[model samples]
Target chain A: MENPCIICVAITGSLPTKANNPAVPVTVAEQVESTQEAFEAGATICHAHVRNDDETPSADPEKFARLKEGLEEHCPGMVIQFSTGGRSGAGKARGGMLSLAPDMASLSVGSNNFPTRVYENPPELVDWLASEMLEYGVKPEVEAFDLSHILKAADMHKKGQIKDTPYVQFVMGVKNAMPVDREVFDFYIKTVKRLFGEDAAWCAAGIGAQQVVLNEWAISSGGHART
Target chain B: MENPCIICVAITGSLPTKANNPAVPVTVAEQVESTQEAFEAGATICHAHVRNDDETPSADPEKFARLKEGLEEHCPGMVIQFSTGGRSGAGKARGGMLSLAPDMASLSVGSNNFPTRVYENPPELVDWLASEMLEYGVKPEVEAFDLSHILKAADMHKKGQIKDTPYVQFVMGVKNAMPVDREVFDFYIKTVKRLFGEDAAWCAAGIGAQQVVLNEWAISSGGHART
Candidate 1:
């Protein structure tokens, strides 16, 4: 069979320290440039999170707009996907970018305890956000922190809120979420295939040491690899 | 809420070697002893695989009977579960011990590629196995290699072959199956809850280093954790 068609490059997501990886982009121009580099690296889709000039996570629509405009100007055909995950805000505030309506936006399927806090997308918020995405013709990339999250995404799909063939992103390696291990990786793919079918597309992002391994697995398994 | 009641201990499963861990039991008596130790270590459920005198994998009814009798003689109250997974021999021959009718027997939900081979449970075999287990009043522990496997298990449940609220086991870390990583674990749990609801009980076993971590998570999350 031909390999899966999509490749998503997550440029400048939350938690990249300048001390750890100086290459992480903090400014809109840097974000755009990084995205361009990924696009040239065989990524047809780009999943992005914007950072402020000071390198902090930002939910500012203006930042998203800047990144979106830059991508449109630099690589017109690339699919620009933005994060609705606030990384530092309430549900309504976290998904503020939904109003901006990019080609795609993230929708976490369920809630789980992160390293020090809980990241939750309440059912009410999920319902509302999903409706808005559908109304605006924006595809929701169901970001699953755990298996239940994929179920939640499936629930949304069944309720006619999310897209029929929703795109899923398996976020691995978060402490208290799922560990970054091969067993967990295999479980996640199996869970996704169980919840969604051949029509659904999946990508994986492993935290820390797992990122490359998960990326390679996704590529080989006919699933998209989101870096 | 009360802590999850189940603790599954996989004692010397089909894989793993004496070279890896000296604790892995080889003989039938050793297997029973280790199983008792695991149960005493807080595992209420024991998943077993019979090995020949030479330490090769064996699905012989006699080995299984010895295991069951040994467990009964040593640890009377502990639940004994057997692997119906025939990694060797003809599929029909794999069910030799089903006549023993232990409390539970694993029914692999679907098939996937392993490191060196492909493990497929054809539909006819699955149906026959499910019917036999049901007739014998043996609870089938639906083993899922991927998401599709879970779906197949669900189908079995709907057909009334498997019991309602079927116990599902997410077998992680097998190549060509789901990887044993945090993200995959999260996806597996979430998917189970989403598909089966909070009423469903699930367990996980991570191959290699993930084993301990999965145990901790399963215990904390109110699910069964098998080593």
Candidate 2:
């Protein structure tokens, strides 16, 4: 039988406003509930972003532990992924997620001018993050915002920071990153295959309306489509 | 001196409704004016989709002739590109733009289900289109919707239909096309480079807000940026 496509539902992201979608989870209970809903919706992975009780983004270890515990209790078999992205420009802030030691954590490979903000992950910090992920047995999902980001990921893999076959998530549709278009998509995918080869597992995520389009392309390109 | 970036502005696309953006030009005169504005805004190339006087989408050759004439009169140096994308499944409905035979015409490399529509270009038709572009001295901008589309472009190039060192534009962020995201961006770029090597001149066009992001990435990636 063919392997089922791995569906990962990002429950609470760092950027989405309550004004955009009312269903975004904020509290611990809300995060747990959202994870459950995503699992029920056929998501094999649940990406958690811990939020303060007041709905502000948080990377507190306690909050992550609570979320992990709650998710494990609610959906035992679901893969739990945590966001290591601290607030923009706060590279040191990624430590919170690392302390929790979840099964997986994001490692943004390069810096780009994100929407209404600039994300500058210094190369030293990136190297340190990669080492930490490896030492902790935490899978690092290389969050690449552009082609250079993928190159950075490949560099880490070459340096033995990441496993030979690492997981890469292409984040598009953000300002200063790759555009949400077919040509950009082709360039990005083609670049990854060239750098990492077919041994690597890849996924795609697009902001806003691009989300659906990116998912469909992932399916067509024989890559895993995450929700 | 650094190579100047080639900016292709879609002065008038066939898809956007007036309600979405009133600035969208509909008539031939309006398209000419928009093209001139884009030229002034540093766009050396202009991608056009003709519309009827009633604001309906049109591929009428006369409309293209009128627009071309206006462009030639207003901006002599600007490269005008015509869209071969007929509405819906009416692929044979070539009209104004195809007849005018401008310097460039978009040749979609593959067919896929568009939102509520289907776009299919058979191999025979692709070969014919390629021959037509070559015969008319019009360069074919192979518009790839996915990875397979890039392969198709490579196949056409191998068949000597498309010119060696072919010019390609990856169109992402369409519903049925590749996603406008980083992973897709990496894969697409890597694939094109691998298939076409250093000889190919490529660009990326993202739908909506992704347009800016993709353009920026293209500029940084050592390719010309065309909207």
Candidate 3:
């Protein structure tokens, strides 16, 4: 029998507001309800980023605690993943929720260009975040903004900074960063296999409207996708 | 017969001060004397940066003009390439030397993490530098600190931002940035060929002890090398 795919849903990202999409969940209750719906529809993982009352992104552990509790009660067995991305906060603030000990958290192992500014994940910060995850017994979803990021994850894993084989997600189609290219995508898979053994698990992500394109690519290529 | 390799000698960089090595040239006179020796030793290109009296980096075009004049008189035909890297200055000041119209200038297309901080090459700065190079008729040596940078160079070429096929340098072995790996080195070559035609020119650079390794790889794989 074919191995079942685990679908991950990003409930509320660091970006996007009611002005962009009125249905984007902002409050804690809205986030839990959204995750419950996605869980019912077969999303095995819930990737979350908390938001303040004013619709700004937040890295509040209290909100995460409430959301984690609600998800446990409403969508039992679903893996919870909090975003440790830079958009919500800076420095250690981004990882403040790690102490809550969710199933997993997004970790960017290297820096790259975002739309207008540099998404900074300095080496010290990367090591600190990985150590925090190790302490809390949480798995990390390595965010591969470019090819080097995936390779850096492998290096970190070998050095014992990461406890297990790093799970990398190839992100594409972000403006001024990596764009979607068929050949580069194939190479990314080859790199993952070469670095983390042939049977290692991996995933791919596409921003905005290109998410559909990544879904088709990931599904046909025997990897996971994020929505 | 094969295409002869063009050797580029970077006499002084933004980092690595005279304190690290007494031989590291900091003054205009010292830099000229160093380049004269390297030029005579078959170095076809001289990549340079200027410094203040106190040994700190400077973006002074006047100093650059003096260096260009000295290189012309002392090492005629040796390609003079000024560095527009962020370490020496901020914003437009980084490109102040472009008006000198040296043979080339280094331009970073994307951002990545350095050893201790973010190597910030924001989009606005990148575009402005490229445009300045275009106006001054200076060829840009696109510094590819990571894989996405090479792709960004290709995109700029397509949009007419870069006047010609970019000369990309794949840099590796920096902490929190791309590290030196054989497979990745090979992939960088393939990516360069895939983006820019098969005949397009490229290069590779490595920090500290990895320089020898990248030199060997670049030469054997039919690309330029910076020493």
DockQ of each: 0.02, 0.02, 0.81
Cα deviation in Å at residue B117, candidate 1?
Answer: 45
What lDDT tens digits, residue by residue, belong to model 2 across residues A11-92? Answer: 8787675777898778889889888988887888887777776667787878888899998899989888888885622656
Worst 10 residues of 2 chain A by lDDT: A110-119
- Regions of model 3 farther than 4 Å from truth: none
* Per-residue lDDT of candidate 3, residues B1-227 (tens digit): 57889899998888788789999999999999999999899999999999998888899999999999999999989999999998899999999999989999999999988888888988888999999999999999999888889889999999999988888888989887889988888888898888888988988888999999999999999999999
Q: Residue by residue across A1-227, what tens digits does model 1's lDDT show?
A: 45546778888887785776999887889888988887887788888887766777888877888889999998779998888784845667777777777899888655444555445555566677788888888898887765555655665687788866777888877653565556556666776777787555788888877888888887787778877
Kept native contacts, fraction for each prediction = 0.00, 0.00, 0.83
Give the alpha carbon lDDT tens digit for every residue of B87-202 in model 1.
73457776778889999988874444455444656555677788888888889898876655565566567779887677888877664246665655666677677668976789
Q: Which of candidates 1 and 3 reaches a greater DockQ?
A: 3
Winner of 2 and 3 under lDDT: 3
Q: CAPRI verdict on model 1?
A: incorrect
| Tens-digit per-residue lDDT, A1-227, candidate 3 | 36789899999898899999999999999999999999999999999999999999999999999999999999999999999999999999999999999999999988889889888888889989999999999999999998889888988899998899999999999988899888888989999998999988899999988899998999899899899
Error of 3 at B72 (Å): 0.6
Please provide, for model 2 over B73-95, each residue's C-alpha lDDT reduced to its tens digit, 9 standing for 90 to 100: 98889998888874612545642
